[model samples]
Target: MATATTTAVFPLLLLFAAAVAVPSSPYLSPTTLFQNYQKMLTNFKIFIYTPAKPFTFQNPAASLFYSSLLNSPFLTQEPTEAHLFLIPFSPETSTRSLARLVRDLRINHPYWNRSLGADHFFVSPTGIDYSADRNALELKKNSVQISVFPVISGKFIPHKDITLPPVNLAARFISAVPENASTSSFLGYLKWDGKTESNFVEELRKDGDFLIDIERELLDPVENVKNSKFCLLFYAGDVAWMVEAMALGCVPVVIVDRPIQDLPLTDVLRWSDLGLLVAARGGAKRLKEVLNDVSEEKYNVMREMASAASKHLVWNEEPQPLDAFHMVIYQLWLRRHTIRYARRESF
Candidate 1:
């Protein structure tokens, strides 16, 4: 009886051993196992590089803008970590030179290229203060992932490599100005001090019978423009001045020949949008037509739309710049990851 019991127990033990010996799945390769492990360990880290200490409104603005990436709802509940590196550089650095420096840093530093992925880089164009020569276009061309929160002058143009959408000031304009105001007319400040010149002013005065200049009781020069139908913005100014004009609820007649590349026109204005567009280099003849074509009804409708648009431009609120930065970073990250995965597959 003891021998028979031992035989039954031995068979049972053998069956258990057999089960343990069976592999998880013959189809599972070593490469697959390694990939799974790699995926588990890899967490892409974003590196933000600034030229100065993050103190001023510009730096905070940049921080707030980039912070949106971590706040994204689509990502998992697990927290992600990113690094910010502030390099103290002279405010006098030219944009062209900065672009070259960034390119050189990325190329020479093996850690930047090999240890960290391309998506890790976030190069800020402006430092603590605004720089005139900082070319965002050049940086976009050289860097793997470049994000610019430029306090753009009217002169900044988008290069082919830069994927940023036009920075729309329409919302800002609408928010700063009173939407309830019935008048669509604006007075443009085109003070001919030999520094700035506009052909539209001369043409409109001659062709459309529009008032060119008026003497007012106020001491300030801009005060006279308050009652005018529209102010012609032939050139771009410092961000503060532009914001002031928008705050005054004055409709800007943008007359720059190049496209309003910085304004997010598509987001704020449709193709049928009613704002007057005068060609900068095309002469005042087209501007006169645009001025004449606008009827009071059309003007009022545009003013209403423009007002509604302004409500969206709350400066303290989550700005469009934040959203724009997140978009470019995510896109580059995805592309980089896809390439990495493809390389692994080929092996």
Candidate 2:
């Protein structure tokens, strides 16, 4: 009996002896990426655990993912056939409760102990602050995390975690950029609170080049964005503007205080191809110089690219082909092979 058990476990241990290295190149050919996406749609399967007891209420934000997964083709009832196990935790779920839930999963299941959560995952709308609860964070360190605000190297581990795109229903009504540059009435536009003492905003105000609105002054802000060549987007704890600007066909000059990978589907799409990243190190004058340096031709190209890429940022009721839902799933599929025991396959 001992020899039989040893023989059975030895093969599984040998299979995970070496870890596969991910490709160094950040960008993959779209053709190859989409091909893998198709494969994932066909083959990838997810198992969402059914708790022994039903909760009193479902979180509004977390319910979006839960409902989508429940309706998705990837869901599986049989855990033995699943490639990933999802812990459907709301963003408001307490650290203590989360720890307890994970403990229960381990105690009641063989899968958690078998792989130590290498194939498990959870969705958090507001992203996790890994430093807040070190003990709780350590419990599921090996599991994949899907979030809206995943910060690379900080709260999120690239290649192991997925950055989910926030839902925006308004994207459906937005129009793409006109083929003619002459259609743009303004060089840039920004809706400022007029209170934040941002050096970038002040500099742009001093230059008198951009149409800056204080408060909700504009009759229709969306229309103004459509008429502008570029949108001055400042990331002040919110990412709604990024998708909004892109969807409206306005090339975004994303003014970020620090370097971050907040954009969704970054692994498959090159953000630099669509929008500009203006570092705060240079202040407003630097922003002016960067925007001014762009040729009319380059700006038009980027505007077109932004419009094309915005499709990946929109979340539909039913998951669409190459939309945000598929993008998140693709990211999860890629991470499935990140575990030491999982075999790496080329897309």
Candidate 3:
């Protein structure tokens, strides 16, 4: 296990540094800012709009969302006294459906027309949050969007919009993989939507000495990652699989087409130390070289880092401080304080 390139010491040092350094930043990150408003979060006022169809509770994201908000310490049933208005809907919930809901609410409520939805927010539980729809466009410009998959560029104003964490594994959902799980396998979880090119997968297979497969079966993603040491992720910046990989003790090998502007829990976790990154230009050809450089000892250390970080990724019925649920709220809280949207002329 005495490898020259990698060791567990690096992660331990990085983790220690993050613990000390985050508190001393000149400007506070969302998680830091959340401390000032922690007390208010429980009483944080929110008025949830009634949709034409009830919000789905069957999906994990939907179910956990209901529990987080309704059980939120900041629950407020009254619209007038609320700090923000929440309209919760699933990924399949269309722009037209939402617009109609808002239109109906605006007709009945003073809030929507009051400021053209500046203080209001809605949840889009999809991988792509930006919309081409007219009403969705207006809200993008005027109101805050609490989204799991956020486009942080011209699509959505990062300061105004909330980038939510994906639904985390509940305590009940955690698979009991041992802490010292073997990682001899590398599983690339790819969507064959023309994104996972054939050439790329072929090149990886040729790179050899590793059991690399894009095999799909009737198994949970977490279970696959748990058995593997490395989980290959592509076009994953907009998704929460990275967090899931880390929590499951798999060092994620994230291949990106461009520079990563931001990531979940940036303030809390030092991701560079915990995983591998490959540029998309000839990225597959470079995968073996990248993982080879990381010694087994170093890989083990990274696994430890992921295990520690996993706790923060969990969702409990009663939300815990800095857990996934609180992280979503913290981002929302941070955005509310970070940006002050002007009234949209008149509602």
Candidate 4:
């Protein structure tokens, strides 16, 4: 008999047992024939739980998550029949609701404590400005957090946790702008308030005036985004325009230091293969040269890629193949094996 010295031993044993010896889940058993028949239809299901209000429009990101989940094909009311448990809550305080929900679940349900929340997940889109009180964000302690902008530092596992694309279709209706530029104009905030690097636009623009500067007040931001051949996208803040540009068949030139590893379908679809990626601070310095360097033919090819990827950006009520709705579910499906539960234990 050998002593198991590695952390991988337990997982490996569980995997082997699942392949050879695990029985049909007792938790899925029904009370009556009618209930049993209903359970038969529940396959590849997601159980939704919100200890607080499900529809909290004050939190735009959270409201979208609830809407998207409700419309998805995998959603179900039956707990035992679910493959994934979704804990949707109004994270106004960020932790109180989560703490109470977990406590309630632990008392009434055995699923959470079985895996210590690895099987459970929640989506809170507004993780920004959470630095004021880091102790309040309950996600750091347990569970996989699905957020638009996850706090990547601390114990937040970027690879394990889901980083959703920010959807801003509500700004669909036209609004006033300064004036649309003759050339393709950059549209969005350049000032780094708190989250990103300090203002560096003046330094980047010194090389050449290839990129047009259109004050957001002059023209419709949508028109500016659509009309542009190349949209100047920085990692600073307000990246909604990237998806907006893609939806309107405009190519995006992403200027950032690190690779965008947290994007949806990263395992299958490569970001660089679809859009332009310029290096860090130096890339910003030589921004004009980088844009000019792209051949007209390559630009067209990139636009085609953008058009193809745009379909996945838009979420529909009816989940379509590779669309935003299915894409999120697909990521969950890939992680299904990681969910550790003690036989849905005798609760």
Best by TM-score: 2
List the candidate 1 regions with Cα displacement exceeding 4 Å.
1-47, 50-91, 94-138, 142-194, 198-200, 203-226, 236-249, 264-274, 281-285, 311-347
**Deviation from native of the Cα of residue 149 in model 3, angstroms:** 4.2
Q: What are the TM-scores, per candidate, against the unseen true structure?
A: 0.47, 0.81, 0.67, 0.66
Model 4 per-residue lDDT tens digits across residues 1-347: 01221232345334323422212211111123123222222345788875555456454444565676676556777888777788766656445545556667777888776666666777766442222222223334345667663234443455567766666563232222222223444422232223344345655444343333434543565564655666766554566656666666566676677665565545334466567776657745466667677776666666666655555565544433445555566566656556433432312
lDDT (CA) per prediction? 0.39, 0.67, 0.57, 0.53
Best by lDDT: 2
Candidate order by TM-score, highest to lowest?
A: 2, 3, 4, 1
Quote the lDDT for 127 in model 2: 53
Show where candidate 3 strays beyond 4 Å: 1-34, 40-43, 57-59, 89-97, 103-108, 112-115, 127-135, 149-157, 163-195, 216-229, 236-244, 260-273, 292-304, 316-321, 338-347
Q: How many backbone clashes does candidate 2 have?
A: 0
Off by over 4 Å in 4: 1-43, 50-61, 94-97, 128-142, 149-156, 170-199, 204-209, 212-215, 220-227, 293-298, 316-321, 339-347
Error of 1 at 64 (Å): 10
1 against 4, candidate with superior TM-score = 4
- Error of model 4, residue 116, in angstroms: 2.1
Q: Candidate 2 residues 264-317, lDDT tens each?
A: 787776677677888767877777788878888777777766776677777777
